[model samples]
Target: MRTYRYKVQTSSYGLFLGITAEAIQLNAPPTSRNQVSDRVWLDTGRVHHAYSGRKLALNGQEVTWLHLGLREYTESIELGAPGSYVLIIIHALEVVDADYAEAALAPALAKWTEAEFGLAPRSGRINRDSTTGELTFSWDERPQ
Candidate 1:
């Protein structure tokens, strides 16, 4: 297996972290006034699973968030404004094999990562594994 890493710097103080699946699902439904959004019914069990049964921390500190769950088939995270750097980790297994895994998903993930953290694409670092099928991306403050 291979591993890939990317670094990003966000202007926003807080970071939004979730699986690509959740991001896609969250944006899949059409916007309408009369209908309840699909995001309201999204299942976020995976997000809980990722954080549970392990000591998960960002920048050497435990991650604190206000909300974590699926609403309308989308997993969401709401951490108060705190940090600027965020690391994005993506595994090949997380996506379907037929989808070409990281190769196909990296671009979208990068775009979402930038938007979620309020960072420009040029401000982030992206790394991908050729053989192991792993992708790592991170965002941090840029030098002036």
Candidate 2:
């Protein structure tokens, strides 16, 4: 198996999460209004979270506002696990194309890593998928 890593660029602070999963499974954001989108405010104290669209999901289940795919890939990517790891499971409805992905997903990942995870952000590369224009968000993080 091959491993790929990318840096994340975030507007938030501190944390960086690298998505090095086996593959990225980008899917369309869910429709129904049963859940809500989260609007967050990171600060000196506890961060504030607001929701109004779809709740975040890790693999295929609902998560708090943390919203990460690779984290849910297993229970522990904590310090010493095996395989690559994915970082986020974001809303991609507005991501009409790759350029949109650049603007939307890229920054989202960075900011998520910074504020939510509290890690410095950087760029990351995905293991190429078989199809083109296919949307997916999943990864593997093997210790090196």
Candidate 3:
């Protein structure tokens, strides 16, 4: 299984959701349009503040894929700055076979969103060691 990761700050909450939805659309499995739902489940906890309750799941593929398919996790890091400015790492994982999965959503999201710390939101593709399952990530230099 491959993991797609993005880095963002508290201020980019809306940007995060936008890019995520766009990424899912970019990588949606091939199927009749009517089979997929347009609705995304978001909770109030992740909507305004606290960062503890915020989670977004795009289970729109249940009809087509027969499963939730895509799952996301957001890690919040407090910087102790005024206004509680914090960094967030968002990760998306596809549970289905790659052939019918939205594996490209992260990369597409990275392309559509702004960069941070001079690095794309999707800093790199995460590789899991087949034996140990240890993950590794790296970002390639693209022409600016």
Ranking by lDDT: 1, 2, 3
All candidates' lDDT scores?
A: 0.30, 0.29, 0.29
RMSD of 3: 16.7
TM-score of each: 0.24, 0.25, 0.23
lDDT digits (tens) for residues 31-139 of candidate 3: 3232212322221112111133344454443222211121111111111122232222233332323222232344433433333212324344534456773433335
TM-score for model 3?
0.23
Candidate 2: segments with Cα more than 4 A from true spot? 1-66, 69-98, 101-107, 115-117, 120-124, 127-131, 142-144
The window of 10 residues in a row where model 1 has the poorest summed lDDT is 60-69
Candidate RMSDs in Å, in order, are 15.1, 14.3, 16.7
Q: Give per-residue CA lDDT, model 2, range 1-144, as digits (tens).
A: 111223334442122223211222223322322222221211111111112233323322222222332233223322222332322333322221223232223334434444444344333333324456343443435444
- lDDT over C-alpha atoms for residue 49 of model 3: 16
Sorting all predicted structures by TM-score, with the top scorer first, yields 2, 1, 3
Best by TM-score: 2
